[model samples]
Structure formats: C-alpha cells, structure tokens
Target: MMELRWLEAFVAVAEELHFGRAAERLHMAQSPLSQVIRKLEKNVGSPLFKRSTRTVELTAPGQALLPYAYRILRSLNNAMDAARSAEGVPTGRFTLGFSGMHNHDTLPRITRALRENFPGVDLNLVGGIRTFDGMRQVRNEDLDASFLGIIGDVGTPLRAREISRHHLGVVVPTDHPLAHRDAIPIHQLRGESFVMGPVDGNSSMTVAALQICHAAGFQPEIAQAVSDPFLIVSMVAAGVGITILPSEVLPILPEAATWIELEGDPVPFSHGVVWSDDNESEPLQAFLTILDSIFPEPTLQ
Candidate 1:
C-alpha cells in the first residue's frame, strides 16, 4: 500500500524541488525524505523525479501528481478545520468579507456583537471593491462568509441570505441648484453631466442609472468614474457632478453635500450574507443569524 506519509514527503520535495530544503521544511532528515520519495515511486511503478549532480526536477509523472497532492492536502486541512469548528465552542479564526452597502456604523455594531456573543471566535473583516469579488472569495474558502450587494443577476457557486435593504437617493453639492429640492425627478438631470461609480464595480447600479436616463430621453454625460463612495461623494462636493447613492450613505455625506430623495421609480439597494454552500460552518451560521436579527426589515410607516 502507498503510505500517506510518503505521499506527503513526495509532495514537499516536488514543491521545493530540493530534497534538503523539503526535509528542512518538513523537519525531517534529507536521507529519510529521499527514501520516502523513492518508496513512493516504487509503489507507483514509475520514476517521479529526475535528479543529476547539479539539479533535481519532477518527471512527467510527478507533474501529473502534483495537483492531486495539492488537492488532497487542501481537502485534509479543510476537513480538520470543519471538525474543529463543529465542536460548537466557536473558537476558531475566521475571515469575513464585505463590499458595498455596509455602513461604517453598522459594521462596528456587528463586530461588537460577534465579540460579545462568540467570545472565543476570532473574526477578521476583509473589504473589497464590491460584491462579486467578495462572493468569489467566500466561495473559494478564502473567507468564512461575506456581506454582498444583491444586484443584477446573482451568480452561482454562492448561497446568499437577504439581510437588509435601503432606499436609493441622489447626492449633490449643498450649493448646487438641486439641493433645495426635497426630491429630484430622474428626467430633470438628463442634460447634465454626472460623476459616476465604476461601471464594472457597480454594474447593476450603473446599468439601472443608464436605463433610467435612457427612458427619460437622454444619456447622462459621465464626467468621471470612481470606485470609492467617499471619493465619489467628495467629487460631488467639489461641484464635479451629482450621483445617486443609497440613502444609508446620507449620514456619512460630507458637509458640502446634500442628499435628496429620488422621485418616480424607487430603486432599492439590497444587501445579503453570502457563504459557500458546500462548507458551511457553525460559526458562519451563527454570524448570519446575528446579522439577520440586527437588520430585520423595518415596517413601513
């Protein structure tokens, strides 16, 4: 039978491409590491490495087996992590990702709640450009979970639970002509130049804004495209141009800017918790439950 220990030795040597270094990394003697590789090759009935006085290299067989070895190691590590997390003690370090719509105030409350409720758990937050990358990171096991924007068509390979929604509004400079208005009609800004978010980063919002403009009979002349909300609002405050943003962002608005309710069709922004369906953890589920309770939909007055 081929031993797992031998396979691990072979993998280490294959990765390092130097037996002495691989032995040091595995904390084993070079002689034993070489013996394990030879035994592994014997069991497989093929040469896994080609070695000369000057160099050591993987043979064709080694190349083919490297990926399988990596997969096995990853699976083993994940399984161990899962088993430890399943103990229900909630004492493992986990990374949580977020992008777009997570208010600065709300995140602190969530962090405090996590600290209070799961005292044993170590939580790390990773913020990204937007939901797409956050979702990808969670699904790929780079993150334990993430808060993401629910917009356009939701992609596959990720499971999401709606946590909250906020109304969209227009942000303009305080001294701008539109600031005096309680709400602005979408059609009224048709001929004006606008500062906008990145089309790829905020694709759903960008598309919706374009469609609204198109329906109103003119295309918005985009003066600048930015990825960060703070920068976008800063540019607006400088009289660059107005932008549409979620109402929750109004509280964070710079002193030079004012927010107005959007008139006509209501464009709602949705936020959700996302995680990998295949490797759901007890800690992740607990975190999600906390989020659901904290941000329950408010009853319309």
Candidate 2:
C-alpha cells in the first residue's frame, strides 16, 4: 500500500529538488528519505524522481503526481484543523470569504462587529478571485460565510441575505469629453473602447456592463479585460478606455478618473451575506446575528 508518509516524502523531494534539503526539511535522515522514495516508486511500479550526484529532478510521473499530492496534503490539513476545531468546546473562530470588489467596503464593518460582539471569535477574512468560487467555499463549509454580489446564475446550497445596493456608473478620464456630464447615456458609449472585467461567468459586474452596452444598440469594443477593479480603474486612468463600475467604486477612483452616473434605469448591483444551511457552528450563528443587527433589512414603503 502507498503510505501517506511516503507520499509526503516524495512531495518534499519533488518540491525541494534535493534529497539532502528534503530530508532536512522533514527532519529525517537522507537515507530514510531515499528509502521512502524507493518504496513509493515500488508501490506505484514507476520511478518518480530522476536523481544524479548533484541534481534531483522529478520524472514525468512525478511531475504529473505533484498537483495531486499538494491537493491531498491541503485537504488533509484542512480536515485535521476542522476536526481539532470541532473537538474543542466551540468558543469562537469564524472564517469568512469575500469577493475583492466588495471587501473594501464590507470588511471593516464585519471585522468591527466581530471584535465588539463576538470578541472570542477569531475573525479570518479571505479574499477570493471569483464570486462563484467564494460562494462555493461558503457552501462547502470551507468558509463560515461570505459577502458576494447577487449572481443571477450559479445557485448554491446556501442562503443569502441582501445587505446593500449600489448603482452602476461609468469611470472615464478626468479630461475626457464626457467628464462634465451629470449622467452619461448608455447609447453614447456604443462602439467606445472599454476596459472591462471578466465577461464570462466569474463577474456579474462585467456581464451587466456588457449587457448595458449591447442594449444601447452596439457591442463595446473592449480594449482590456482585467480581473482587478483597481487595475481596471488604473487602466482607464491611463486613457486605455472607459469602464463601467459600481457607484461604491467612486470613493476609491483614481485622481485621473471621473465617475458619471449612467442615465436611464441602469442595472443596480447588490452584495449580500451568504452561509451554508448545514453549518450550525455557534460562532457562525453569532456572526450572522451581528450582521443582521448592523445591516437590518430595509422596510419598503
């Protein structure tokens, strides 16, 4: 049977690319490390490393196994941590995820609430590259909760509570022709060069921005597609192209960029707190309660 220790040894050797360093890292003798690798190879019926007097390189098989080994190790660590956390009397330790776009505004208040109300809880905020992936983590119990934009698609097994809404707006260069306009009509931006975010499944902002352009009767000519909002704003500042972003982004706009509210019934973006139905942790519940108190649902007239 392939042992976990052997896999660990192989991974260390593969990463360090030196038996001596790998052995030192594992706090073991080089001979035992070499033996472990041999055993692993025998078990798999294939050599994993190409070793010489001065160099130790991964074989094709080793290269292929590297990603699986790392993933397994990460999963094992997460499982052990989760087990240890659950075994102890649940005092507090909340892990939250957030989309990078929403974190600037929501993180401070969330952290403040956790500090004031659930002082015992260790608040860990993780930034995610994509909203859907972050939502998946929340649903999978990897994250206790997350704040993400309201994705019309890619439904999850978690419940979401709407917290805030922001209007869509255009970010243009300060000296641009439309800079002084109170509100820019979407039609006027047709065929205009744009700096946008991921237009695929990852970002709702990108999808909505494109939809607005298409509705205005012409597809936007994209100059760049960047994932980071700050980078998108910076690109616009550099006169790359105009960008459509949430109004919340106005406060963080670069000095060279000016924000203009989009005229007509522009699509508003919403961000919300999400958590798994199966996550019954007291800290998570307490955190949710704090969120409810801080940002209560608005009563419509």
Candidate 3:
C-alpha cells in the first residue's frame, strides 16, 4: 500500500515542480524526496515527473492523478475530523482573513454560525487585508481560510468556493451628467477619471474595474486609489471621480451618489472563501462544515 506521505510528496512536487523546493516544504532531504517520487512512480508503473537540471514537469500520468490525489487527501482529513468530532466537541483555534465587502450578508452569517456552533473553538476574524495578502496567508497557514473578492482562478495548492456573485455598477456623483441615466455603457467613460482601491493586489475591485474597462477597449484614468470601499464611494460623492463597483456596495452609497448598472453583458464578480487543502485541523474542518451548509453546492464561474 502506498503511504499517505508519498501522496503528500507527490502533491508538493507537482505544485512546486522543483524537487528542492518541494523537499524544503516537506522538511525532508532532497534525496529521500526523490526516492519517494521514484517509489510512487514505480508502484503506478509510470514516471510521474520529467526532471531536468533546471526544469521539472509532470508527466501525463502525473497530471491525471493530481485531482484524485487531492480528493484522497481531503477525504482522509475529513474522515479523521469526523472521528475526532464523535469523541467530543471540537476545541481549537481558527483564524479567518478577509478583504473587501466584509459586511456582505454571507460573511456575517458565516461568522455568526461559527460562533454559535463552535463556541469552544477560538475564532479570529482579520479584515482590511487585500485579496492577494489573504491568499498568501491562507497558503502559508497563517490563516485557516480567507474570504476574498477574487478576479480569476485561486490557482493550485489553494482552493476557493464562491460565496455569492454580484453585478457591476457605476457609482457617480448625483450631479454628474451620467447620474440621470439608469445605466451606463463602460465605453462612455473612456475619458473620465475613476476612483479605485489600491492597485497593490490588496483590492480585487481594482482588477475587476480595470478588466471591465479593458474589455470596453480603453484604459481608465484613475483619479485616486484608496483602500476603503466606503472611502472610494465618498470620494466619488465629493466629485473626486466616478468609480465602478460591485452592486453589494449599494447600501453604503450616500445620497450624493447613485449606482447605475453597467449596460452590457454581465461581468462575473464573485465573493468566495479560499483555503489550502493541506490544512486538516479539526477547527478548520468544523468551520468549513458550517460554510458548506451555507454554500450547499459548488459554484462554478
């Protein structure tokens, strides 16, 4: 029987594509990590990696086995967590990180559920961080999970499931020319200035707004880049510049500003939770169980 440690070695190598880095991540010497890969490949009767002095790539078999490997490991973790839960209430610590739209209906409800269900587990809610920071922290295990406003795939080693989707809208000063219109095409704002969140990967909103403008065939003239969504709206209200945002921020819009839908094909904007598959703490599992109850089904964007 193949040991679980071998699967761990396989996944680490497959993700990093560098035996040295993978071994460092696994805290094992490069020689033993290489031996484990060889052993796993032999048991499967195929080479898993095409290794070179500088480049390492997964073979076809390795590619095919990757998803199953993730599932097997996740299943084992879930099974273990279940067994532990049967003994008594779970007691441990879980830290959750979030960026943008912290007041979204889904997030508050999830936190409330966690407090109610796992009172024995200490919960730490960290907010105001950016999406990229949250992703990095979750992968590094500094946080058990992160709620993010992501523009694209969450990528490998980490997984994300959508919490909710939002429609794109334009926030303009009540006195602006476009304010009277119920909706605005992105192209109309080509020469207009925009207020957006910081571009330092902290704000997925900035990326989403830029992408919308790019699709409309122009680069936005950014007037300001601030971190707070509320502040972004306030800037627009004070005539700093108009801005694009997800509809979820509508409630916070002051009377000085109005939100108009983007008059075009819907752009995909999603809020989701991100976590590493390698974190198997019972507290995390319990928290995830609450999340699963809320999301119920996987959302594919």
lDDT of each: 0.75, 0.79, 0.84
lDDT of 1 by residue, 147-255 (tens): 7667755566677776667777788899988889998888888767788767675444566567667877888899999866678889999999988777767667899
Least lDDT summed over 10 consecutive residues: which range in candidate 3? 292-301
- The lDDT, on a scale of 0 to 1, for candidate 2 is 0.79
TM per candidate comes to 0.73, 0.70, 0.69
Identify the superior model by TM-score, candidate 1 or candidate 2.
1
Looking at model 1, the pairs that clash are none
In candidate 3, which residue ranges exceed 4 Å CA deviation? Answer: 1-86, 100-102, 296-301
Q: Candidate 1: where is the Cα deviation over 4 Å?
A: 1-78, 82-87, 152-155, 201-204, 297-301
Could you tell me which 10 consecutive residues in candidate 1 have the lowest summed lDDT?
Answer: 292-301
Better of 1 and 3 by TM-score: 1
The number of residue pairs in model 1 that clash at the backbone is 0
Ranking by TM-score: 1, 2, 3
